[model samples]
Target: MGFTQADYEKFRILRVTHVAKRFDELIADESNDALLPEQLFLTAADDALAERAANRIERAVKAAGFPIPGASIAEVDYRDGRNLNPVAIGRIAATDWAMTVRNLLLISPTGGGKTYLACAIGMAACHNGHQVAYMRMDQLARRLTIARGDVIAHQKLLSDLAGVDLLIVDDFLTVAIDSEAASDLFSILADREHRAATIIASQTGPAQWAIDLPDKVAGDSIVNRIANNGRAIQIGGVDMRQVRSHEVADAL
Candidate 1:
């Protein structure tokens, strides 16, 4: 009875309001036995609150522009020939690294499911109650280029990227990063380093990153930021797309 609407609202426990409302209805029922005090607290701790929180997290994740819809860790296929280490992946998924300033690098050839795997991890991080964002390097570079002349807009974009718990950059270093792009990219990484996590999916390996970067010093700096403390997973095998196409052909 001491639980007030103001208390719940102040604490941002919106789901508990529904419980309190239901309790009020039950207490008012003529045939109902009055709810016990412990039962009232138990109602607030129920699965409903967890579900509501999960839904909100999902919505936030979707709003972050993840390209792969419905991607999930459970949906990954570990087919033969793909040299994926399940133990390593399991450790990565089971930990809070995505929320604790760690980094993941997915290196694989084209059509090797690098993007899909990165998205799945991003989705998993979202499920773990972390904010996430996803973008292709080319797309992000274009955005950065467009915002270059506008100081406020550029800072705002960097600020937004830095704030995410897990920022996934698909197809990173796919093309030569020129001076302008390198500067912008460095700013983002510099802002995020030691403060949050990043997942970079690339067909190019780190050893070759320096060659592709137009600015060698900047490129090395960026690579050092990622490679120094990041976990690298090399995915090598037949293209999953080709395999899927063959399966579809057989079905047809």
Candidate 2:
């Protein structure tokens, strides 16, 4: 009635390594002798599913390209001066808004952890089985501009960006956008509108975005879609980079 060598070989052939490992452990442990056949099978199946889900999340997180890959919403600092609302953060972390195709705007001063917060939200989305993409506005503009040289590459890039479940744009509107880049950005945003979620992390709000872009109409349209469709989280705190530096120096 016990699993034979042939059974183990069959598990290996089916690539159910987690199930195979679990079965090996259960068989090697005398404490599991009293477990019913159904119980043992269910436990091994649970282990296999859990391992596969964890691996899928890991792969999605890696593909997200988060600058701060390890950031977690649960670890956010809630110090008195930070002005972070635990309730709002919890809502964001739940990722229901993202599933509904809503957007988020993270407004903070330089070094106020906007990127970290964005990454944390992205990590949450990934955990919820959503695909995520992170890109700095300047870098995205450059990529789109380069892709424009090739029609196929240009369309493919837009398609890829539009297809992601969540797209995080960091340092948004930090630099002046030329007409061509503005047009490309508008196209990407338009494609994603009402279909996918986007997170804009910026030191400045949407008010200044229009003035910074060469094309007035495209700039206005972009700002309207992002600002109007998204909820804003304003982070007020001392510069986190400086705070960390002081901590390191004190330790030294």
Query: In candidate 1, what are the lDDT values of residues 1-252, reduced to their tens digit?
Result: 444768668545554565665555555666555668577556645645776887887796776688886777777778777877677776676658544777888998899999888888877777777788899999999888888889999999989988888888999988656699888888889989998888999998788887788888998998988878788888986698998899999999
Candidate 2 deviant stretches above 4 angstroms: 1-17
User: What digit string (tens of lDDT, one per residue) describes model 2 on residues 219-245?
Assistant: 899998888888988899669888888
lDDT of 2: 0.87
Between which residue pairs do clashes occur in model 2?
Answer: none
* Model number with the top lDDT: 2
TM per model? Answer: 0.83, 0.91
| Candidate 1 Cα misplacement greater than 4 A, ranges | 1-15, 21-45
